[model samples]
Target: MTAPSRGGPAEAAPAPASAKPGSRMFASLAVRNYRYFFFGQFISNSGTWMQFVAQDWLVFHLTGSTFAVGVTTALQFLPVLLLGLFGGVVADRYPKRRILLTTQGAMGLFAAALAVLTLTDVVVVAHVYVFAFLLGLMNVFANPAIQTFVPEMVGPERVANAVSLGAVNFQSARLLGPAAAGPLIVVIGSGWAFALNALSYVAVIASLLAVRASELRPATPQRREKGQIRAGLRHVREHPELIRPIVLVGFVCTFGFNFPTLLSGFAYNVFDGGAKEFGFLTTAVGLGALAGALMSARRRSSRTVVLVGTAAAFGALEAVTALAPSVWLFGALMVLVGLLSVTFSTTANSLVQLHTDPAMRGRVMGLYMLVYTGGTPIGGPVVGWAVQHYGARAGILACGLVAVAAAAIVGLIALRAPRAGAVAGG
Candidate 1:
């Protein structure tokens, strides 16, 4: 893709024969390929979040067991543990657009299936578990491919802008999805939410079809050598710079910010409210996350200081939220916690994408996703059990403690890594 140097819509477009792609926010939107994706993804992400809220509600209502909630959470992410590494390999070998189309369609089907089951009053815990697993399996391929495809939409120089724009889209969706879902669930029921999610897939598919491949940047060359996956693993282990952030993100996501599972407990035990209150808790977080994304978009930093800072802030926020002693205060603190959580996550994602090379970007991102997904798989169960036995406040406090501890350790490690390098060279 051609990089536009001067200001204009052309700057966001793929390198043209006559123009340079400018480095600015919304730069990728100048290009038709990315513009389609940006809007499509925005719509899709909103619908996905709606489904997430509905599905969790469905499972909780069906079982009334925290363990079941955790299991559902685990099922959605467990595939990342089992197949994320290989999924990266697949992304490298296949055409990303094709992969995305297939996966998005599959995910839509899964959501539709859930809607059918629930609407018919035949939905069972096992069915939810099965659908969660199926969705996770599809994500193993979809997530990595989508991340790797960003550079193709706009070149490396404008990557930060592209990343920021994408973050904005996602954050906006997150904010809108739950807010809409809460009312929709009460009025029409969770089945409608699922149906809306299914319909959302069409937007993404249409966007994918409308984009021209010639406008896309070249794909990374596939590595077909034996033990290639092992080589990828070795590379991550050997490079602390790459692996360090991934580990930190995992820790924060798992221990600090897996709130969907705990939110129900907080609603019932802590706040003594219903589904509306629970949904509002999520909406509060979404609002905070949107603010964080917009703030990050303004900065021009290579290091994700925002991410680390947010991790620490999230831990602190969680702790404060846990001590609110009232529903209103707790909801208010959750907004701050949500903002910190998104700030940390989006910054981390941008950092990872910025530093990675195209050849191994898919695999490297997959590793990042693995740590993220892997963290949830383990953390969900632990957090769920904690809430079930301990009071909701205690469970949240434990999660906060884990976040603070992880942030401190990772912060020290990040600081030390560079000093260690300097010392060795000296």
Candidate 2:
């Protein structure tokens, strides 16, 4: 479990401890703990993406209806709405490494279950729904813990770099997973995709074990409140600056960027293509997202600037993408959309972590996810129905309009709030 002390596929040598501060994008990678996690997560995320692609394909094979695909996505995200706030409370109370160890293992088992069902030809829409829900529940906790863990491992000063690096890792998986899965699913079947994901957990678990506990910065110490969840909500409600971006992300996730509903329709109907085209579209997005993350990594300004601008731009880009004439053009536009999305996402993520107290990090991140992923449940059915009735292009246009409006409203509010405060002070 220990990070390999020397050069090994699994082992990550700690970066030289003595690198003077204010280095570059991968500076945090030099730190032993972060290096271990970075590489481990990189390996595991590839499998995760593969599973994601396979699951989507399996569900589509089972039902062929776009709404059914939306439902599977909905079921997977529903837990974030219901339990994400509470999951944060759990993350705050426990040793994050220990919590991750457990959750990651549970997720692996869930993947295995899906694999069993698929391989045995017993996989049904209902079975996919059940497994997706279980994984969603696990994610309500795992997502926040992983988000907060970066700051815990690398501290605040290097947090931007760490966040960028994490985004890069995620994008790489997004790129590599679907590209590989498209062929693998064709050759072996969806079950192998699920199986690969189950095995990927081993990398993360091993990295967690290898990490030195003493290296992790401690979470904040707070008196355990009787209703901690409510307190967290109250905190967010009272702090628009802290909560608004998360709300924006959720809005985008649900309305502007419900890919399962939006892009699936595009792939199946508008483009007249199948899994390969879909995978190509997602891979193109990953490429753009990787670009966005790299851009954010090099930024040296206030986070609010990066977040607000990128989000607005993303919305604009999505609107244009909705009108793309050809499938190739549509795929190309998606790359831009993906790039802007990651720029906004990574900046928002780093900001939330940077501003939060360690004790409340998990809870705060949980709220972020609740707003981000939870929106899917609330918006999926609506978007799905829209796609069914109106047409996929109209549905996509609507999503884009919603995103643009949210950004405009929120951005104006953010601007006005500061002026209002200044007046009150005067």
Number of the top lDDT candidate: 2
The 0-to-1 C-alpha lDDT of every candidate, in the order given, reads 0.77, 0.78
Displacement of the residue 370 alpha carbon in candidate 2, Å: 0.9
lDDT (C-alpha) at residue 328 in model 2: 94
User: CA lDDT of 158 in candidate 1?
Assistant: 55
Query: Where is model 1 more than 4 Å wrong at Cα?
Result: 1-25, 60-69, 116-125, 183-189, 419-426
- Write down the lDDT that model 1 would get: 0.77
Per-residue CA lDDT of model 1 for 148-185, tens digit only, reads 88777766655655666777898898778977888899
Task: State the displacement of the C-alpha of residue 362, model 2, in Å, after optimal TM-score superposition.
Answer: 1.4
Q: Write the per-residue lDDT of candidate 2 for residues 70-94, one digit (tens) a residue.
A: 6777788888889999889988887
Clashing pairs in 2: 2-210, 14-32, 15-30, 220-358, 220-359
TM-score, each model? 0.85, 0.87
Candidate that scores best on TM-score: 2
The superposed Cα distance between candidate 2 and the true structure at residue 388, in angstroms, equals: 2.8
